[model samples]
Target: MELDILAEKENVICEMVSNLYRTKSNDDSEIFTSIYNQYKSIHLQYSELSKNNLEALKRGLFIQWYQKTEPNFLSGISDLEQDAEKQIVNNLFTVINTKQVDSELIWMLNYYNSWDWVFLNYENFRRFDTNLVNEANNRLPENIDKKLMLKRGQMGKYWLSLIKYGSTE
Candidate 1:
């Protein structure tokens, strides 16, 4: 996806994730609904993110935003059915929360190694290390003030002989 629109929605994504924690619902359905809404918003904004990920990129925005900012950012879901997607996300949250150290070797003994893997490969992604990302951030639209105009392109049409459409009138 082009970094421009993603950058535009960066704040939006952050707030959505933050809402997960802000949500105090203990009902599994409520929790699931919240997650589903957030997921849908992210997916809608980026329908082309990946072929299949919630298998992996299914968490496209989640993964990208988390990697750059913070991981295990929020896991507000709870009491979901055993087959709950929350369980999957919670586990993801756990693993992501543990990425504090700067060592890949720290995960040598880890099992169930394939979480959040998009079923297909993605291309043209923006990374935190790239200056283009900075430019994209800078290019986000800002709030603008609009003004009312008093006249039209024809200068209000005050013609002396223009009382009727036909000159013969």
Candidate 2:
């Protein structure tokens, strides 16, 4: 019974994580926010597991989730601090520096480098007091391509996240 419960919790966490990536890929901020909150709640439930399982499972989340088959736009989903985990962070830094990223991640890195564009409002322009970016009536730009811009506008957020969490936030 205990094993079954533990397995179920693991499955729930896995599904929640998949949902997070899906929402992020789709650029669905509303749904992503909802899933993010729910994941936090479900992860907290892992404490009910026996033994040192919670810490072990956290390691798995970082290893399988952040360091694997797909691009990890969700890099900071956990916190990686131990010496062994630092190796993973170093690997990512090397990949970024050497331009040797996996093909799947290349597009995301390109989009992020593009820095994307913004949709501002009258209040925003007034706040910045710059006529540089005029209001677009709170509408997306005509050339907006969400399909090609999944992580475009998140540079600062991710940069700070990588700095603080070291790629497993």
Candidate 3:
């Protein structure tokens, strides 16, 4: 399947996970576990395929992790209770660290990781490290239009606010 289509599917699945997490009902744990296991199965299958497929899988996993690890959710769950979540993140880091990835994919992964980090460390953002931001800025494509750059800047600021203050609105 095309990467865009796969990305859309990933988004849908991640949204489902997010909704399950937000529900806070008694059955949420069972439902979340089922969905997460299915996601991991699909992720492992894609990881064994071509680089593009792996990238899509990583992107989807990262999006789900980002949503689930939001400050509000993380406050209630201990890392010891999230073995699967840790494993998924560790797998993503391992893949991104490999030498097999091309420069473009590396840049894209770095951008996504850094953007997600901003949210993952929302409470401690004041003391957050700048290395990821610096790396993302350095990897930015040259000669990009001012409009696109502005949009990216705006997004970063918006995400920062959402992390530090809560809510996108």
**On a 0 to 100 scale, what is the lDDT of residue 150 in model 2?**
24
lDDT sort, best first:
3, 2, 1
**lDDT winner among the candidates?**
3
Against the true structure, what is each candidate's TM-score? 0.25, 0.25, 0.40
Backbone steric clashes in candidate 2, count: 4
**Alpha-carbon shift of residue 49 in model 2 (angstroms):** 2.8
| Candidate 2 residue 79 C-alpha distance from true site, Å | 8.8
Query: How far in Å is the alpha carbon of 65 misplaced in model 2?
Result: 9.2
CA error at residue 19 for candidate 2, angstroms: 6.7
Please, what are the lDDT tens digits per residue for candidate 1 over residues 25-132? Answer: 555455556654554444444434332222222233333322323333353222223222333334334434454222221221121122324211223212222322
lDDT of 3 by residue, 44-92 (tens): 4444433444554444344344444554232211222233344444454
Which regions of candidate 2 fall more than 4 Å away from where they truly are? Answer: 2-27, 50-169
Q: What is the C-alpha lDDT of each candidate?
A: 0.32, 0.35, 0.43
Model 2, position 54, has a per-residue lDDT of 29
Flag clash pairs in model 1: 53-56, 53-57, 53-58, 54-58, 56-116, 56-117, 56-118
